[model samples]
Target: MTLPGGDGPILTCEGIGLAFGRVQALLNMSFDVRRGEILSIIGPNGAGKTSVVNTITGFYRPQQGTIRFNGQDITGLPPHRVAKAGVARTFQNTELFAGLTVLDNLLAARHIFLRSNILSCAIYLGLAEREDIRARQVVEDIIDLLEMEAIRKQEVGTLPYGQRKRVELGRALALEPDLILLDEPTVGMNLEEKEDMVRFILDVSEEKGTTIVLVEHDMDIVMDISDRIVVFDFGVKIAEGPPAEIKKDERVIRAYLGEG
Candidate 1:
């Protein structure tokens, strides 16, 4: 899938550094995410993979480094502003409104696109009504895309873990983001559920042409779905390449296991 913009890096991180007191979470991290490509970030625990996503999405501010998205400097932008700039993210932990229905949770993500004033919304007239209808239509399409029709009306807190993960994904997609960061999207899933999630992720990239930055621990899934893999160790990038090249990297082997 070709995006309107030329084949340039959709997101670029330059010299990113983050520290919590004395522990440095990320150190001089840099990477590029090409438009419409699936880039997977893999690392052992404490390798700072999630730290990178958090910094990019504005959940955490880096002490140093500049982040660019769509050629604009987004460094230190708040989460909502970054989202407004066409970035959406699903957390390593599900962040859905527990008491809300799947549909309502998805609708909440559409708030960023709402253009109606309080008066128009209260009256439910004109642009307000039209925008509400459009939002619902978008949510419905996402529900169908994620195969959540049966549980659309169910409260998220009552759903199974795997299904809740799907709902979180649906909520992110509801924003119609140009770039989506998925954090351990298939974690805690059975084989069947993992397969389903993988198919849905691929569908989003191939059909919607959305660029993806995926953080996953499942090596098999990462190698199978990623166009390129970035490996991190001790808060620094150890290797970056295609799946085949990453699979054979000695540094990656040593990071995951011990030197033999």
Candidate 2:
């Protein structure tokens, strides 16, 4: 498919490929994420779904092809650079600063905006104070948006698994990204928590206008929430379309559910 250009997709990966030593993890995989859309990447284990996320977010460099975000080429940029360029991600495993409070973790994500040098931070000068206050305000807003105000001061390590996951998401959002890459956002949650996460994700897309590219195993969640679906099998693109169309795809059924 032709990638959306000036009036098109928010993100696009064309002919992306990755290899580890002699093994190929992805082979000419390609897809597009339209602006203000939720696109889910679904596949079985080792189907290169997570690799695609890593490639897009610059955690891993693709051996071939390119990634474009906001109409600019960003292939192989470092992860920090990618984040600064408005791509934010939450890992499948929550990576919270365990010893820190929820608010502290969120505030830490604003380090990119710090104006005070290490010397000024050590001295706690006027500029340092102002930066600290500004970061805190941003953190507070994120906490309120994620409905974590009740636990803002609580240690992230002491929170429940689901809440820790939410805290991780809050930290990612603190970057104020234009695109959010979610890797299995609802992996271990109970039904209630999963529902809440789904609501939060939809709100983030609808209210925040953040384009979301999700790598998730929960078919129910993907089908219910995704505007489009991309299916992979053994590192190959087997199907790409809306969820309803993907659900009826013969290749998807054979690869994921086995042919009857």
| TM-score of candidate 2 against the unseen true structure | 0.94
Q: Which lDDT values do the candidates have, in the order given?
A: 0.93, 0.89
RMSD of 2: 2.7
User: Model 2, residue 132: what's the lDDT?
Assistant: 96
Tell me each candidate's TM-score: 0.96, 0.94
Off by over 4 Å in 2: 1-6, 257-260
lDDT of 2: 0.89
Cα lDDT tens digits, model 1, 64-168, are 999999999999999999999999999998889999999999999999999898898899978898998999999999998889999999999999999999999
- Worst lDDT run of 10 residues, candidate 2, spans 1-10
